[model samples]
Target: MKFKITHVTTYLFDSEVFLEPHYLRFRPCQTSYVDVSDFITTIHPQPVGHKIVQDEDNNVVEFCWFEGMTTQLTIRAESVLQTKSYNPFNFLIYPQSFNTLPFQYNDLQKKLLFSALEQLPISKGLIDYALSILKRSNFNTISYLTNLIKHLHDDFSVEYRAEGAPFMPEETFQLKRGSCRDLSWMLIGILRQQGIAARFASGYYYFDMIAPAYELHAWVDVYLPGTGWFDLDPSHGIFTGNTHFPLASSAHYQHTMPVSGGIRGSANSKLNTQLIIKKL
Candidate 1:
């Protein structure tokens, strides 16, 4: 499938203000399954400087600095993408690892997955909650992971907040309701608690029912012993594949913000965004 994506964000301020260098993570990283082409970013109030660089996570980052004061700032990103049917389960079990969960990684793997395995302080409450879903004595690793995902999907209702930071894992667990980012973060914590190397992922979700439409979506990427990273979306209770296009995956969610910057002004501001993803 081929897709054309356009995302426009406009900020209206009551008074003119200087803008800081803005970081845009709108460009998708080229992968075996997805090819990105004809990408462009246009900024209103013309930026004085613009440069593109790759972050540590390999995401394409666009940096722009505005020189003059302006009352309105608009940023537009457009791209054409062609995606193939990437079977989530296509890879072989390299080095005879990743046949299942509870597997160990070699030295190279340890270095790469070091940060991902760093565990957070887990409360007894969380462990109890997790065990409630475990149920079976002979728990297969894959089955446990799958059940964990399905449990979150079926047990919680999503409360979509268009803006703001994600809720903490504890908050999401107690409330059982959160936005996509919140759920993804909580899932990462859960995976890490179980010694699974996981990270937060943000991207675009394309659905046929909403053709020509798109959404900023979040999910989790867990490291499979020999197969590398695989994406799993707790909100959808499925492995992300053809329908999901990842923009960034990092240990922190803030790292993948689509557009973020600071403006020096006391005036009130309003934001508006437009997104459209069309099949081509």
Candidate 2:
């Protein structure tokens, strides 16, 4: 299937402000089951200089710089892409040890996935919450993840607050509901607590409905020894496949933001975002 997408982000400053260097991460990579046929972005008050480069996290990003002051900044991106259907479970976990709770990664794997495995302090209740799932899954790695996401999907409600950083994982777990990002982060915290390596992913999700609308979506990636980084969507209670197009992923959600930069002056700003995706 082919998809055409248009996404616009506008920042309206109440007062003139000097623009700073910014980075855009709207380019979804060409993967084994996905192809990027065409992609382009237009920026208003055209940037003075820009180049696409891979960041430390290895995300394909557009680094841009600007000149002069402006009251409004706009970025419009359009793209056409093709995605193929494939089974999300067409992989295997390696190192038999990793197939169970308290997974033990090989030395090299642990060294490389250090950040992804790091666990921030979570509330005791949340920790116990994850433990309950671990118990329910009988300590099986794959079953645990499947059960975790399913519980979140069936128990939690969805919210559409299109802006702001994701809620703290502990908060999301306590609240029992949140935006897609929040649920993903909540899953990340739970996995990390169980010694599983997980990270954040952001992109678009194609809904299986008539004339579906889409916004930026967030999910999680769990690293299994032989299978590499495995995709999991707690918000949707499934592993990802063709319908999920990931733009960028990082150990931290903030790093996956489509736009990253700052203004030079104290100009209060209002942010507005619009996204449209269609089957082509």
User: Candidate 2 residues 42-99, lDDT tens each?
Assistant: 9997999989999989999999999999999999999899988788788877778778
TM-score of each: 0.91, 0.97
Candidate 2 whole-model C-alpha lDDT, 0 to 1: 0.89
Task: Compute the lDDT for candidate 1.
Answer: 0.82
Off by over 4 Å in 2: none
TM-score of 2: 0.97
Report the Cα lDDT for residue 142, model 1: 62
